[model samples]
Target: MITRHLTDISSKGFKVHEISGAVDTLHNHNRRDYYKIVLVTGDMILTYGDQTIEINGTILFFANPRVPHTVVHRSKEKKGYACLFTEAFIAGRERAEILQSSPLFRTDANPVIPVNSEQAAFLGSLYREMLSVHRSDYDYRNQLLRSCVELIIHEALKIQPSPNGLQQKNAATRITHLFMELLERQFPVESTGDPLRLRTAQDFAGALSVHVNYLNRAVKGFTGKPTSVHIAERIAAEAKALLQHSNWSIADIAYGLGFEYPTYFNNYFKRVTGATPKSFRKRKV
Candidate 1:
């Protein structure tokens, strides 16, 4: 398959590599003790598990250490910066809260936030400061790293989503927030081989330790869609992404997605996409 490449550096429990130029390769980088926060200018495609988001002039977060992903530069020339830090670099529990409470730990949204001119300046300054400490022979590198990250989060919180979009969130909306967290955690994994990985409400209910009927009721009440439909939609979305972007064949895609047979996958893809996987991939090509 034509996958992006990943460059991993985890020596000293954490490391950072600054990147520039078009994203061409498909690969992954893994670190046992670190998470990655990327601030980029220009444009690129980021594939995190099953979701691939188009990003430009944005700050994005990747929280899970187990999931494999890659960033591909779409242009002949691209520029960006990335920092990988271990939890140890964060030091105190308060710093950990910054990551957990923020949308960085959540996977539901595409999670790409645009940077305003002012925010961009702030981020650039923070990154420069962090780089300075990283390169310097200073004795307080850890303290400087922690402080720079704090500044980064402060700047990120200043960003406001578009007014015309999702309403402003409040703590009063607790159930929905919890529901979104649960949904995001499960949505990307719904497909086992690809024909619809999560085929039943009970499957999710079991995972969440709730009654199947209650799960169905909550999902339907909140989203106006039944649990099964939501699961199907998520699987279909992932199917389309694999078809469009990867070089895997239709049968291989079906198997990768969890379909038992190519025929079943073809039928399901046609049902949702109004085109077979082959046709859809061809069109994208």
Candidate 2:
């Protein structure tokens, strides 16, 4: 499936939808551009990264944009609400950092937690409030919605930690974390002329002040993929986003993505996606 980005949500930067009717149609095993929190109450299976989890009761789950995951509903009836919002929706807020660093949203941390009846009631009420505010005519609805989002996050923080516990941090894990963060920070390319600053594994290693081979080994050891592969995948993802969402010409997109020539970008894109950039854009259209 094509990864869903912030633009796929409302221009207001947030959306809340009931989960039961939509679970079957929701995108599966794809990366998304926004944060997701869902309150599920039924039998379901979730696959996050490399782990698979089964839930049979009330639960609250968080998914970050950087982590790829999917959900499978086993029962015919499900009850819950899911809200999605972009980082920009919460930017400059006091709790933005808390939201970003919370274990519930961390890629390496367990994202699902079982909730008792009272906790489920409280969380469900918050979702209901958010849905109500979303449909209201208030001028400050976005602010109200953000507050509800923060409340949901804070509540999840108080629940029991993921059963998988915390991941032990080692040199390889640390380096890989830094590399992935640095790579993600360059994403969602904002303008046609705004080229990606770091385009290669060597560039990332240089930025991290580590030797190229050391960085590669660390990344590969932790993620089971070469550093170059990660870099190329991220670049390809951004290239697809730009080609689909921006008015920029192919040459401009190439330059913006740090390609010296449009032909190089074309070949690279075809190599990575099995389609030329123009064809990809056409197919998307």
TM-score leader? 2
Task: Give the winner by lDDT.
Answer: 2
**Tens digits of per-residue lDDT for model 2 on 1-285?**
112434546576788876664347233845455778889898888876556788899998888666567878787778898888876776556875766556444454567879999999999999999889888899999889988888887887778553431343444575687689779988878776678889899998755545689788879988999999999999999898888888889898999898999999999999988999999999666
Each prediction's total of clashing residue pairs, residues at least 3 apart in sequence or on different chains, is 17, 0
lDDT of each: 0.60, 0.78
Q: Candidate 1 residues 1-285, lDDT tens each?
A: 111112323445445556675465543554434566777776667775555678766554544453446767655655556677665556477676665544444323234567877776777777777777777889988777777777766556557354333432221122233444444554443333433334556765553334577566666766788877776677688778877776677777787666788999899889876888878888785
Model 2 per-residue lDDT at 43:
80
Residue 11's lDDT within candidate 2 is: 71
Residue 212 deviation, candidate 1, in Å? 17
Candidate 2: stretches off by over 4 Å: 1-8, 21-31, 103-105, 162-166, 169-285
lDDT (Cα, 0-100) at 150 in candidate 2: 83
Q: Residue 172 in model 2: shift from native, Å?
A: 7.9
